[model samples]
Target: MIKFTLVLFVLVSGALFLFGSSASAQNGTLFFSPATGSFAQDDSFWVNVMVNTQGEDVNAVAAYFTYPEDKLEAREINTANSAMTLFAEKKYGQGRVEISGGKPTPGFSGIQQIASVLFRVKSSSGAATLTFASDSAVLTDAGNANILNLVASGKGAYVLKAKSSASSSPTPRPSSSVSPTPTTSSQPAPSSFPTSQPQFSLSDVRVDTITGESARIAWVTSEGANSVVEYGPNKEYAFIVLRGELAMEHQITLENLSPQTEYHFRVKGTNAADKELQSEDQVFTTGALQTQQGKEEKGIFGGRGLFIGGIIGAILMLLMLVMVIARKRGESSLFSQE
Candidate 1:
């Protein structure tokens, strides 16, 4: 036993010494690039990956790194996901990379690069966190087999955000220059308009479901104006009179409109003195309103069915209670007689 133990100790010590020498040889050797910071959305960025071999000839070695999806988009020449690319920075000697496309290794390892990968992030609403990693495969210029010194870094990008507008008003008429006469059917609707130069803009433009001979008109605006709608089936001048309003937006139900017919309308902004300005024309088509009435009727019928079902359930519960009470009473009488 003593002789066997002595032999084992010598072999273990020699192995430990060789391992220490290999680790120390890779010291003072490192590789990196200059771009290490946050980037904007929809922009391109690059990084260089290298290794320090302590003045030793390195060959046939591979490296890899990975970034977050939201932070960056990458493409390599030999990668499966062609949309991603590995940028070739001039600082490193020109060596083309061949991407190996396959299932990512466990823990997202296969997504890493042997050297470097380039990224192009698109517009995003929030910040994206990114990570990078690398691997060292067999270095074989002269039969040296030692892969170590794996390093990683992380960064982020900021994306712009968008929001919907808050205004809710009808569109105002164009300046008097745009509309010469804003009269309706030889008569003007009762309304007050801005005495100053009419400023007009449009927002919340949408189409509503037209039914029967009516359609609801609604919009949002910053200023109140005397609103008049000029509409016709074909010719531009063929017009009709809508009500007048001084509110920001006007919701008017156009009455006596033809079903399934296309019509165009232009809103007029008028002053007390009969000066008029018109907005750009808007067009829409009317549809049959019968479908809307049928839906309402179905809703009412469903509510009535629920009410009838509740009444029936109450009657059945009452009947059950009466039957239970009669049985208990009969059992008590029989017990007393016995």
Candidate 2:
């Protein structure tokens, strides 16, 4: 038992993003490039969050932004050519899009692209606001401290016109030269905009294989909508997971969890035209991580498989010592006590 405990102790080893202001600072800037725009209903547009570390060597970033579910539908998140080469998460739902990503050892500085979100105008002739959540952060590689200063970190407002008629000319999106805060005065919806909103519904909702540390939820909607999964250790779930881009089919992964815990989770999706669909609270006990020679076989570690090898080596050493002691005792018996 002592030996086993020692082996366990030896095997267990401890292992251990973006927010803030639109304007560049000593720490960094976490803001969308084109802060304001206008579009007709059903028209799609893209906006991206950019960062400038300003000579600060930072490694990881996380951004959380919210839009009006009634007016705009998030379709997808694009990371191609993004400075954050590794993404810890990409999620959107309930008019919220969250992205947490990072780079390798030396970290990154200067100007770079974080992520691009494609949004489709859904509601007719309404004002929409997409702004960064205060919880967003840009973490330093050294200490992982959040250095984003969000005091007046810009906000983006958009005007949604009714779908253009045959003779109407689409209003060109405004320039980015001015403060783009969301307000009714910034750009008002035309008087001809549609007034009816929708009550959305969903189908084919399912929860897939939930492992020790991650849970996957999937659902289908008649129309493209944002996806959000709320999960926690119990019924009062405070954690949120989102997949911002809107689509009829949605899949979301909830990770970083404790094993053997009973977690309560629910799914919420909002489609264009101010419609929402939700699932009843569900429960599931998490599972233990599957491993070959003990310890995680795959995951964030990405190690060289040294843990199992050390355990095996320790066991062999113990066995050899026990054999040697037994042999010496046999020899001390002096041929059956002759």
Candidate 3:
């Protein structure tokens, strides 16, 4: 009886351990669509926040996003066709925005669209980033249990270019009496002036160090020139990095990047003669979010295996106990007959 009781206790304890570990191991991801892009000054654009449950059913979500107030203005929040049945939003400070909402019943599974925010560009010519404040963000299951540990990645950015003055309608020139005499003949000699613009080249453009949240880019120019880097998640370069100084070598670091993401970038330089040069677009991808996720998965599977083994061992022990009782009863009956 004692042996049978001990076996049952072990089985129950192992099953409980396995269930707890598996519950905590589930993970998910939240990200933005049209992650990177460029816009002209005063141009309006929209970004959508998305969630991938990663096989986990999530019922509630809270996201906090921020941008450069001087460069962008949050215009509106759209929740049409979103997975969220009810939502509330708030805007604060220069460019901080917060959104919290959830589906009432059944929650959400697989990939879901949360909300979309519209923004208008304000900066004349510069780059700005839209970042998710992970510390303040939260994701929960149907029971309102915090599951933020499952969030793998969520960060993004945008760049704005000032409208060129040349593109605008030209102002009419004032007529003046100073337009006196026109010269009939005087072609300057070719030797008296430089014919072509200065020639230079950009080389060795590469991504130096990349992490889940940042990246560093470096390159060399044949001549000293002002350095600029335009990059984005796609071929359309939308973000710009300016050194604002002349140099033969240049390096720029981009921050607030998402993990397991691919980015496209190109180099630009302006020589002393004001001639501009651009390089071909290049690409780089950030590191994956596997370290923590891998450990969680392992723990869950290992716990399950242990639980199954414990159940099997408990059944075998019960069978042995029954066999021993049967043998003892038979021997006692035979002795009584003798």
Q: Output the number of the lDDT-best candidate.
A: 2
- Writing each residue's lDDT as its tens digit, candidate 1 over 1-338 gives 66654554353333333432343333212233322234555666654343334334443233333445544566532323221222112121122232221111111111122344565665455544332234323231343334344432222223333232223212433343344454543343343344355555434533455777777766544566454455678646343343334556756555567788898876554433333455677888998657777888877785898878889999999999999999999999999999
By TM-score, how accurate is candidate 2?
Answer: 0.43
TM-score of each: 0.32, 0.43, 0.43
Better of 1 and 3 by TM-score: 3
Candidate 2: list runs displaced more than 4 Å. 1-26, 167-338
Order of models, best TM-score first: 3, 2, 1
| Model 1 segments more than 4 A misplaced | 1-209, 220-222, 235-239, 271-275, 291-301, 304-319, 325-338
Ten-residue region with minimum lDDT total, candidate 1: 102-111
lDDT tens digits, residues 1-338, model 2? 66754443232211011223323343456766455567898899998777656557787777788999888899999999588776756788789998876776678865567888999999888788888887777776666656675553545667788875654433433443243555445555643253454336787767787899777888888788777677787776645555555798889876666887888888876665545677888887779867674555453255546766777899999999999999999998987798
Give the candidate number with the greatest TM-score. 3
Quote the positional error of residue 238 for candidate 2 in Å: 38
Cα RMSD for predicted model 3: 18.9
- Order the candidate numbers by lDDT, best to worst: 2, 3, 1
